[model samples]
Target: MSISGINNYNYQNYYAGARHNMAKTGGEIRGVLSSTSSASSNITLHMSDVGNSGNALTAMGFPDGTSASVFQADDYNPADPEYRVRYWDKEGNYTDTMVKVNDIDPQNASYLEMLAYTSYSDVEGLTKNAFGDFMNAARGVNGNISYDADNIKEKKDYMSMVKELMQLQYDSNNLPGYLSYKELYDYMNDKING
Candidate 1:
């Protein structure tokens, strides 16, 4: 049950029949296990076969020809990353293709900071206006400037403040006009933290 130091397994030694050949090349192979049994389980394997002149092919095999397929580098160029392996069927229709994969690298700290600053600057003007309106409404009630109509002025003032904050967050985050409940929560967090 304890598997350690099993870093690599070589399969070139497993091929025995004259129908198969082996070569050393750099690539990956993927397959799936068919069943849970140890002896009767079916396994598929792929191999990169390189000729003497450094040409390569990705040979794949399964239990049947109709179910299994192989992809090989047609225009084999050793130095190019854009080179790919293409698969085809007996009818000459394309099936699958493989290409080099890479991940995005995050190395520009200054650019990230500039993006954050620009995002902040783009929303500053709207935030200021919203804050001003909320403060004015709050002051109108506190100063008794609207005494005649109703005392719901305090509630209205608080609602306006909430609306202003919500708008600020929404506009800053570039959220859609129709706000979802989860989006509102995320906007609040991003506004407070970012």
Candidate 2:
């Protein structure tokens, strides 16, 4: 369960570790079909048949294996009561944790949509403050990141504040004189725009 030594991957050893873990966990990879074409010298895969195959997705769709639940992504609205996120517990058991939009981290909002099976609307209600908090924590801005809480309520304004904070942090770091101001500015601009 501890993969500390495998932090950085070496292509040669990754598969060996993966196979060992797979065997130990009784993990089965379904719906993957591989076929090689002799003439074309290529391989093709057909995976359209795999529908909601993950453990959390399966549990949400058919909890009892017979009756399908009424869990519909299209039906989810951010203004609704709450949003539920599915994550694996320490024992490898899938657990659904309901969270409010305010508590959602803006940095991992899209990741939550994919990995946790949360909807876009679930994170649509996140405020500027939440994004600021995520940026601060991620960048280690601490008390250095400053913004007018009352005036800068819009998302765009908060993003500008983040760009400023990034610039401040970059300036604070005493890099070699060879690194030009334009280089850092361009890098920060690209990050902010992206």
Candidate 3:
């Protein structure tokens, strides 16, 4: 059945519109309790309970009795895979509406952990050429360079490169206008040492 302006059940198409609406309005299509406080002024919504309670259907305007028929089987088991409802507010502030599903239930945790692990794995694969170049430039002869005692060789190599860059900077009139490398290095070292 279709709501007046909304289309009939078409999972793939429905989510796009739902996401768009939630993003534009800073409104939620679903939410779960995160925690509860004994203080009368604050009440937390346990998202899992909300999910298990099948409140999303009611918010979507499904009749109370039909919630199970609409969302779950006769046994009242969840049909959807684990997921948390989240969106950014109108002012671009991020709001996490629910704890990730995996964090809620140990049984449900694998998928989210796997997703996180995969994302970090991808980040690890990213080449650091830009960062390496920036580090190299920073160490130039005009740059104060120092290293911890643990990796003397690596530090020496880095400082050697920095010295070359500093020489180049000295030869050219374009050294950065900030404090000299020695002064900046001394201040930073003092702060760290203290």
Q: Write the per-residue lDDT of candidate 2 for residues 20-137, one digit (tens) a residue.
A: 5556546654321221122333222221222242222222211122111112332345454344444333233443445453443333333222222223222343221332233342
Candidate 1: segments with Cα more than 4 A from true spot:
1-55, 64-80, 90-92, 95-98, 103-194
**Model 3 spans with C-alpha error above 4 angstroms:** 1-134, 138-156, 177-194
* lDDT, each prediction: 0.29, 0.33, 0.29
Q: Which residue pairs show backbone clashes in model 2?
A: none
User: If the candidates were sorted by their lDDT against the true structure, best first, what order would they fall in?
Assistant: 2, 3, 1
TM-score against truth, every candidate: 0.19, 0.25, 0.18
- Clash pairs detected, candidate 1: none
Number of the predicted model whose lDDT against the real structure is largest: 2
User: Which scores higher on TM-score, 1 or 2?
Assistant: 2
lDDT of 3: 0.29
**The candidate that achieves the highest TM-score relative to the unseen native structure:** 2
lDDT of 3 by residue, 41-145 (tens): 322222222344343211111111111011221233233223233222223332223222123321122222222212222223422222222243334443454
- What stretches of model 2 exceed 4 Å from their correct place? 1-75, 102-194
